[model samples]
Target: MTLGLDEEHRELGASLRAWAAGLDGPAAVRAAEGDPAETFEKVRAAAAGMGLAGLALPASAGGDDGSPLDVAVALEACAHALLPGPLLGPAVSELLLAGGHPGSDAVVGLAPGAPDLVWDAPSATHLLLPAPGEDDTWVLVEAAAVDVEPVVALDLSRRFGRVRAPWSGGVAVTGLTRARVRRTTVAMAAAEASGVARWCLETATSYAGVREQFGKPIGSFQAVKHLCAEMLETAEAVTAAAWDAAVALAADEEQAAFAADVAGAVALDGAVRVAQTCIQVLGGIGFTFEHDAHLYLRRATTLRALLGGGDVWAASLAARAASGVRRRVEVDLGGRDAGVRDEFRTRVAEVAALPEDARRAALVERGYLTPHWPAPYGLGADPVTQLVVDEELVRAGIGRPDLKIGGWAAPTVLEHGTDAQRERFVRPTLTGEIGWCQLFSEPGAGSDLASLRTRAVRDEAAGGWRLTGQKVWTSLAHEADWAICLARTDPDAPRHRGITYFLVDMGSPGIEIRPLRELTGDAMFNEVFLDDVLVPDDCVVGQPGDGWRLARTTLANERVAMASSRLGVSTERAVALAGDATPAEQVRVGHAVALATVCTLLGVRTTLRSLAGHGPGAESSVAKLLGVRSRQDASELVVELLGERVVLEADDPQVAADVHEMLMTRCLSIAGGTTQVLRTVAAERILGLPR
Candidate 1:
């Protein structure tokens, strides 16, 4: 889905898409490639007439007076068609002219340097050239003064011409007007990338669904389906990144710089990757000149090269993050939250004013602790309400104790447990009086949890059930007061069936906990031995032989929190470590920043889906899959940036921490769900591939 796009943007994109579809974009691009000077004066004139050249310019200056975001929407639609034109360059020039340049009606071509690879240079009346040694400052040169040289580029759909020295008619643009031009250029470029990725995704998916192989559609094949799924994730990321960049630039927020860099870091890569994957999914036909896939690929790659690649932008983003730059998402409460925000904020403030020790109790009592939970236990808070409460609490300097295992356990208990079970466990868990741990994973049953061998036999004499099993990788077992566990209850039943879900007191006799040191040199995880551990009938979370279904609740909770929370770890670490980074290092840090931003956007989309009464669909799984990769990559970058100090020294605390964090991040992929397993699931379940 396109992130944060309103109806106007959607219609704008649709209208352009329709217009380009009728023009046969591929044929036009092919025509342009064959003869660079064959000047489609009519086609360029058509785009200009449609206001493509002046979308962001003011009506006073004879233009649409659109915002940066509106121009971005138009560019994306244009990119979908691989439509050949001087749209981006002209948009830059018009925005410059609207910023108070004298020649508002002149056709302008924008080039970063000495007019090398500049669009429409031979055709334009003027060229907008950046000043040699100044940042965000440019010189407007009349086209007739600079001799133009035509050349072929990787993207055959677009024409390019170069212009060099000894040119007069130079007018300088500095200050705010120059800065706006720079940022808007980056934002529009990102939007173009986003459009390219979107087109690739739609083309590949549509092709895969119809293209047959071995008597079935290729989309039915796991490999093709997974590739398409990856393209979907990339496309979504590009959209989110581009949209944020556009919004930030238009709003002129402090986040504009980092947002622009993030867009640069993510959008260009996504465009290229998605385009390449589109070709892969389409197979041999994708590689042929007859197909339009190569055109988009060329455009994606060329744009990336021109922007100096994702690494360059990523490194700058990292430095800003290090300097404490944050992209605070500006949300307009609008009519949706306006009615409830004040009352909710006021009540939240009242509870927050209480003593720190008493705040948790008050929050639980007033249903502010877990707003998403049902009434009597929580406020049954919708997404909007929850956000309001979060904002209010953060404002008041109040905090709630994280119910780690309780987040999953309490939800399971609320959904499947009895009234008595809910009364006894829910409040205490939410109030921070009781801590919980999960004993669901073992050596053999982590991802394949159905394969658990731990047995739970009914014991009549003790008047309960006895659980005997070895549960490994149980975090907080050394400190938790209780645990929600899964054990096999029926030997005759299928692997997925015959298991039961139970809550056991950690203090129960015959329970043994052994700390397991990790690669990070920490022992937060432990091996628990449950030899003759007794759990009463009331402790059964649901009916016997229902563990598999109940386990899904726990996993669902894990998936919800997966990308959102883990995203901060590497980002915070990267920010802490990135101090005045070199260009190369900035690229790496920028990559991390972009990934972090995407992770946040994914969460926002998931939340929007939840609020809309739709399941997060496959994107939720995609988030976890991509998140693990991002965090691991980011973690490795940290160590790589440290040179050889990481390998040579453990005495330095900072070095030691970096080393430990680097090693610990390895588990990111292995834990929750292995990257390989999740990809397969996304292919089969999300992308609708054959098992």
Candidate 2:
């Protein structure tokens, strides 16, 4: 999201990508496959010539002492070009030494577990691992003292071999902990994965732009467009995950472990998906050995497997989070936004300092309650201003009361209602003095919301209209003071053209509300019946037959309000619940953690786009699609983590809550729009697909 990415970093990445192109790209990668030694020397010499060997090493050690993020950017670029050589292990070794492990000039390699094959062992002067029969200590053995037997590897881009080292004569190293080593390795691997994913995205997109089918570029097809869009999303997610790891490691932040686990958990899987999809985009050529797509897929798969795959890391993420670990992604609002943000922060602080009971009124008086609205009612904030206000509010531990339906309703009214209507409703709605609910969806109409059967007959004789309709899934209807309604004003008109927008009083005659119990055993949703309810003409929001249009606006508002930078909330709780989780449950928990992190990354990318002057864009739609999946998946994991405890004792408090949350997630996919419906939206609307 460009949180701390500078021009220098951008140039560094570009330079590396270009440099890798000049070195050996995918063609070289394929040739070096199964036998890296033949082609390794040339790239090694080139890297050393560019001083890449000591990039992560301290300046005092004749190195650049580059930040972890800097190293990550470089790796991502290198991997994007499929640049070969034993890069990862040596860089990691340099980082370890900087952290006080003893090593110099010698290439260093690492082995993860007991009696493991160490990649790049042939080129290493030393190897590091936990010492045998030693407590909290590590051993560094000379390469000559180790037996290296070359073995075939899935990713032929790098070399690997079995290593049997003499630990008895090894140098004992202090302060190089297992936890630290694992964190660094996982983080760096994710960084490399990010590069692979980026290359897949770029290559596939570039191909789509040129490849033609049925008289047009393949990119013009909805299927291809959607594929590319998803690829873009995965690319961003991979980068975000890797960036989190690199940032945490370089800063030695509190979330170093948490961030690294999430990166390893999500990046590997995302990279694999992206690479495979890239092949699909390339069609027949992608399957042939002549194409480079398989090479990337191999490398991505190997890297994922090298670190015990996404499942292992995901489980680790859940275990860590369950232990009260949290990861937060912070953005640096550069230049003008930074100064503007500080100014708003102080004002927000002043309002926040008030007693809890009095805070709402203060916020309203300052026009911060609905900053996106026009002046007097609000500041009419632009995207940047809106985000600044949002950031400040979250920081001050202050929350603005959600105006419920009024959020969209009031905006709809202001945009279309007469001054008298505005004076009667907008102010109170913004201040929370009036509560609003929506009556748009009917049992027969959900995603096809325009097909609703509610009736609103005009009564010119009286100054109002008689309304009769049934609204399903009407949340807050039982508690609402007012409702923004949709009813068919003219059944003779077309399906979408006949609906009209109206505001109905909850206390009106013939209005009945029955609670609809859900799988959670909670009646948060209700079925509202309006039998001949009277609605004054003044209560109408817009011209008759405008319900569908206004309802769409309200629906959009709902989606935006529901969007968030959090998905791991439940997973974190589930982690705590599954402290002694079984291996299977641990893997499930890990999957949830990874999903949550990716959801967050997606949201960050969206906000970044908005802040960059792009209005919402494709992510707004894409997020809903993925977010529904994340929420539902995480909820299911919570229940699965509980295992038989949930089934045996359905009434247990914790068990019940987890079950309820899981059941509640069912609505996510069906609510604003079904997953199928959203995908089509992305394909046709965003991706330019045929209907």
Candidate 3:
């Protein structure tokens, strides 16, 4: 199941956002709190005015005549702003109407205390209650028929009224069946839970970035950072699961049930964890009545139990899965192909066989090498196949082969390179005969790559061009055979339009390479001074002024590459680390491990999307940020578990390695993209914030 907003869906989001942005904002939500009637009316009016009432309504009804996916879209936007009863009412009613039930003047009653609750019983036209069995079947009742008695709720923006209905007009859409209703309601519940989880994360994260303590934003501290990161991840998992379920519901019934089950369990878990961690991150104020964090927490606890809890879903899924038990199957790879499980034996064999460079040669011979390169370049594996290759490599304890030149530089050439250019560079990249480095980043231009100063002047005398400038952070230039350089080929045009991508040989005269010392004391990056480095005209990639667009194909893929962690560990590490530690230490370790596994899965899920042409988008940035946070948490767990030894040199190899890894983890945030940069990227690109 796929989850994303296409162009039209995005347009719908913008419209809804603009409408909601005009409402009272937090001030309105705050004002309406406690005054159930006033708040419900205000929120309800706003929601109805925006067509939330008819979002999933069929054309036969007085509705937008849309799909359930459309309803999911509207619900997500409403969830983002913490919109109150108004949006919830229509959404619930629309669901009822979509299911062919009589839903007018009906309100949806979510399980009590659902965080991000849009359910306000007093204002709902009908209320939907969960009745669990093989599928989620809800008992719907008219608001008038409900013997609703108002109950005080933690969140003032929403109010709950206990409802009892024993009436016939509360008709079940006969053909829809109990199982189908259960699936839909569970999916909706999961979606709403995700929305709440996200809100908590966004709230805590924004606060962390600004709320200074001890002369620094608390977010700078590893403790606060880890908590916020966990919150973000919890939110992400819920969102991913919910969307997966929603899309599945739209596409297939059985998958929808599985998706719903997964969503319900994960969303409930995520909502609760995110809310609790957010409260901890916010400290004292987060616990106060004046703060909104508690409301979300209360809602999370209530809603998690409202649907069949996580244990119930887990049991259900487990029971179903166990019934499918079959013996493990094996296939012939002819000592050529390897499955994920073959890693241990494969690694032992690879290490034993390697006398010197035979291992590299074997990798190339076996087709596992350069799996990321397009077909003609080598293994010809697509991203999905590449992921499988990566997992096998990591499991086998194999290090990533040095291929900055071929793996990174050749893809763009294959996509846009002239036939001559591809013939010259492609095969060599796979064979590892030629090494490459990128020369795009500069002091003045980082994210803004097109605003570069490097120039490639026409050198008709040599039937090529002469380039002269400095390029910073050029990895592998010291050993590079060539560099794929982006330079100003038509300086008179607009910044983005004037650039050209060129292939520059490192052996060219006047090109000098110098390694830049890093905090880690590794000179992995270099600054290259290109002084009249000549490049033949045949080396020009694509057209003269299409470099900016071509560069994206390379740069965007870099995020997915970096996200592919070679140091693959598991939840077991986190669990074992804290078992013998103090209480605080155990919680820290447990949280980190669970968080890491969750984040790793999220990374895989998002990578799948990016490979599908969704681009990295905001979702990728969120994953990257979460990855950095997970690394930090893992580092802290190691440090705390080791106690005094981390602060002092250790004689034990394992202890020494732990300390080294802790220090290395510091660079996690600084690499791929900084946490700070990714946050702004999320705000601008994902959240639709202004520049």
Question: Which candidate tops lDDT?
Answer: 1
- Put the candidates in TM-score order, highest first: 1, 2, 3
lDDT score of residue 477 within candidate 3: 80
Model 2 lDDT tens row, 1-691: 2222455776788888888888757777766764567677678778888778778877677778788887788788778888777788887777766744343355777775444678677677787766766666777887777777766678868877685544456877767777787788877888888889878877887788778888898876767877877876676667777877887885554578888888887888889999999999999999998888898999899888877777878778777766666666665556557668778989999988888999898888777777777767777776567767777787898888978778878888877889998889989997777898888889999788778898988888888999998999988998999998889999999888988889899999999999999877889899999998999998987888877777766312122121243455567766776777787787778777776776776666566555555556554566676677788888887777677988898888878877888898899988877776666566556545444
Tell me how far candidate 3 lies from the true structure as C-alpha RMSD in angstroms: 10.8
Evaluate all candidate structures by whole-model CA lDDT and list the values in order: 0.77, 0.77, 0.64
Q: Which structure is stronger by lDDT: 2 or 3?
A: 2
Best TM-score among the predictions, by candidate number: 1
The digit string of per-residue lDDT tens for model 1 on 1-691 reads 5543555676788989898777777788877765645545656777877767666777776677888778788888888877776777777667656755444356788774233557767557887776655666677777787777866789776666875554555877655344455566778888889888978888887888778888998887767877877787788788878887887875555578878888888888889999999998888999999999999999999888766678777776777777777777655445687888889789888887787788889888888777768878877776667777777777787776889988889999988999999999999998878899999899888889989988999998987899999999988999999999999999899989999999999999999999999878799899999999999999998899998999887423222221232337666776666774566676677788788888776676566555454556545666787787787888788787777777788689988877777899899888877776776676666555565
lDDT, model 2, position 172 = 71
lDDT of 2: 0.77
How would you order the candidates by lDDT, starting with the best? 1, 2, 3
Q: Give the TM-score of candidate 2.
A: 0.79
Query: What is the alpha-carbon lDDT of model 3 when measured against the actual structure?
Result: 0.64
Q: Across residues 1-691, which tens digit of lDDT does each residue of candidate 3 receive?
A: 1234455666776676567657744556677654657866777776766667766777666667777667776676665566766455456446644746453333455432332232566676665554323244445556676566666565555666664433334544334554665567666666667767877878887787778888887776666665665565567777766665566566555556655666665677778898898888788889887787876776667667557666555444433222331111111223333444355346536753676456666666656666555544445554545555665665556664666556667788878898888888876776678888888888787666878998888988899888888898776788888888999888899989988889988888898888998655678789999898888889988888898888877522333432432223322333445545665655454345334434544665556554554655445556577667777777667767778765575877766666666676787775555666656555444433233
